[model samples]
Target: MKDRIIDCLAYEGKVSIKCMSSTEIVEEARKIHGLSPTATAALGRLLTITSIMGYELKEKDGNLTNQIKGDGPIGILTAVADSNGNVKGYVGNNTVDIPLKENGKLDVGTAVGKKGMLYIVKDLGIGKPYVGMTPIVSGEIAEDFTNYFATSEQTPTVIALGVLVDKDGVRTAGGYKLSLMPDATEDIISTIEQQISKIEPISKMLDENKTLEEIAKLVTGDENIQVLETINPEFKCNCSREKCEKGLIAVGKTELEAMINEEEKIEIVCNFCNSKHIFTKEDLQNLVDKI
Candidate 1:
């Protein structure tokens, strides 16, 4: 199936669940970043969840950024998403390779290390952005996000993120985020908890061709669910050479002059899309004149 994010309400609207199949998005990222298997798993999981969270933004101009800085071989991973759930991300070490777990699973926790923080920044294009932070619990994206919601946002949440990678590329990737409304009773929460414990990984379910609606029902143990919205998610970068020029101009006239005098050409590469922008010395001079 195509990459899609579905928002649904279960348990008669007392429980909220967002499900997404992000295989295409993750595969594109793998090709763009030349990611190793473990790196694909780590960053892919981050990108998947970030897209779902970004879809929660109310304003068209709003966005969300998720940053994971850990003490592992994979130094850092960052993903950004627009209000429409288009996401782009880059890893600190795309070539990072480590041994898998004894169970033959990607050791994302070890690859991401548990000694840092998970930063969630929400910019609503308003007064000031809100930033929430929580300690990394397992360096597994889902567990870290679960802690973030419980402690930083004071919301009870369950998150599942998975990315299956092989020699070809990302085989499957997806996730789900479920939260309880204030009015959700103890019985409802208990039922959900039980259901979640028995469900398969999100990626596995997606790989098995389970639709988001079916996954929602499986996870929430509610046969009847209300679909709120369905959106297509994509791996898109908004970076451009014009944006690069603006960044270069921000370095001041003196810096521009210095660049013009010392360098024959300046090449700016975007971390998100790996797009390169080249500025000749004459281009620098022109920018200085504009200043």
Candidate 2:
């Protein structure tokens, strides 16, 4: 199925939930970065979670950036998502890979390391954006995000994120987050927990072709979930040649002149999409003249 995100409320608005099955979306990330299986899983999971979190910030005024900086070989994985479902991210180490764990599962914890921090920065489109930091709980992502919600946002939340990658590339990537609002009752929380505890891994569910709506039904149960909206999520970058030119101009006419004299062409590569933009000497001269 095409990748999409679903928002819902359960127990008569006592609980807020969001689910995303972003196989195609995450596969695009893997292809863009040429990541190994382990690296694909890590980046895919972070990208999926970041996209869902971005929707949570839409009611506010700005953007959201979620960064995972670990002591493992991967160094850092950073994803930025906007209110409109546009998301982009990159991993500090895209080639890192390790042996699987004893359970034959991707050793995300070992790859990410137990030490480091998960930083979240939210821009409200006004003054300064708010930043929050929380120590990593389990480098496995879902637990780490859960810890972030509990410690940083002070919301009782459960996050299940997963990404499965084969030798070919990412096969499936997606996740679900269930949050208990202040009005949620103890009984409701207990019931949701019971359901989640019995379900399969979120990634496996998606791999089996489970839709976002189906995942929600499994987690929140059939009775309480109220599906609100569904959104198609994809890898989107806001970088282009014109934007690169504008940036060079902002560096001032002196820099442009130096580039024109020293280098035949100025090359700029986007970190998010790896798309390269080249400005020839004539192009540089035109930019300088415009300034």
Candidate 3:
């Protein structure tokens, strides 16, 4: 299935679940970053969870930025997403590789190193943004994020993120986040916990061709769920040469003059997408004149 996010309510609206099938988007990211198998798993999981969290912002104009810093070979993992589920990000090291776990699973925790912090920044296009942080639990994206929601955000949450990669590329990538609302009862929560234990990994569900609707029903133990919204998620970058030029102009006349005088040309590359923009010395001179 194409990349998409589905929002639904379960247990008669006492709980909320968001499911996503992000294979296409993750595959695109893997190709763009030239990620190795382990790095692909690490970054892909971050992108998937970030997309789900991004869609949670109630405001249409809001955006969320997540940074995962650990003491591992992967370095820092950063991703940004809009309310509509469009996301872009990059890894500090895109070529990290390591041996798999005994279970034949990618050793993301070792690659990510189970130390450091998970920082979240929310920008609603209004007042000052909100920032919250929590320590990484396992350096596994889902576990660390789950710890963030429970400890930092005070929301009881369960998150599952997975990416299956091979020589071809990302074979399967997706995740699901389930949260218990304030009105959720002890019995309902217990039921959900039991169901989660029985359910397969979110990626395996997607690999089985399980639709979001079915996954919602299975998780909530409610055959009748209220489908709130269906949205297509994409791997999109907001960077442009114009934005880079504006940044260059903001560096002040002195810096611009120095760039013009010392360098024949300067190239600015976007962090979100590795798109490069070249500015000739003449271009720098024009900016200095405008200054």
Highest-lDDT candidate: 1
TM-score of each: 0.98, 0.95, 0.97
Clash pairs (backbone) in predicted model 2: none
Model with the higher lDDT, candidate 1 or 3: 1
What TM-score quantifies how close candidate 2 is to the native fold? 0.95
Question: Which model is ahead, 1 or 2, in terms of TM-score?
Answer: 1
Residue-by-residue lDDT tens digits, candidate 3, 102-204: 9999999999998998999999989999999988889988999999999987999989899988789988899889999999999999888888889988788
Backbone clashes in each candidate structure, one number apiece?
A: 0, 0, 0
In angstroms, the error of model 1 at 243 is 1.2
Cα error, residue 89 of model 2, in Å, equals 0.9
Off by over 4 Å in 1: none
Candidate 3 at 207: error in angstroms? 1.1
For 1-291, candidate 2 gives per-residue lDDT tens digits of 677889998888888889988888788888899887888888888898899988878755567899999889988999988875568898988888899999889888888889999999988788888999998887888899999999878999999999887777777888889989999887888888899889999889987887777888888875657888888867898899999989999999887888888998989999999999999999999999899
State the TM-score for model 1: 0.98
Model 3 residue 51 CA deviation in Å:
1.0
Candidate 2: list runs displaced more than 4 Å. 59-61
